[model samples]
Target: MSRDQLVTLAQALRELGGAVPEPVPSGAREDSSFSGGRARKISVSMPEDLSAAVQQRVGRGEFSKYVTEAVAQRLESDLLAELVGLLDEEHGEVPEDLVAEAEGAWPDVE
Candidate 1:
């Protein structure tokens, strides 16, 4: 991604109160051979209240795993949103009936 895209993504993550990871250096290979189950240690900052709430739910020992899962989900959501935007640009907006049919097929959970 371009530096501008990286900056935009970092800003979006910060807006969501997520710990934005360090950006990859320019010209670096974007993909790594690291396995999904492998872990890397990195420091991150978050609000005290949010930290406390997460700790209260998952306890300190499981904090890293919890954060990892949350970040992964957020990235997936962002990618899906981007794909939708691309589709909209190419094909115009989705029809309301089609959207309603999709909603009926996969209704939102409480």
Candidate 2:
């Protein structure tokens, strides 16, 4: 499988409480305030089966952390998709050679 597919599978496994490697931070953004601030309670309704599955996987009293991680992952995916769509609209599809060049240069530091 491709690296992207593997990554998606790993994230799914994490959300389901399966053993997986800890994710490395992307380094694109850092917001420490969220971690230090108070957390407000929010209610959400889901299908009974999904709720049951989540409860079974994460157990009681841990739903908050599970939901927080799930929401953060989903929001990251949504933002990335939106950014890609906007870039495609503004610049058309990126060229293959340019993509290769960027990939080649990515590993080296000045």
Best by TM-score: 1
Global local distance difference test of model 1: 0.61
- Candidate 1 has its poorest 10 consecutive residues by lDDT at 27-36
Candidate 2 per-residue lDDT, tens place, 1-110, comes to 22344357557655555455644334212232114244656689899999899999989887777776676666556545555665576669899999889888886733
lDDT of each: 0.61, 0.60
Please write out the lDDT profile of model 1 over residues 1-110, one tens digit for every residue. Answer: 34446556666655555565554334222232212233556899999999999999997687876776676456556644665565576679999999888889887743
Error of 1 at 73 (Å): 0.6
lDDT of 2: 0.60
Model 2 spans > 4 angstroms off: 1-34, 97-110
RMSD of 2: 13.9
Q: Residue 56's C-alpha lDDT in candidate 1?
A: 100
TM-score of model 2 (CA atoms): 0.56
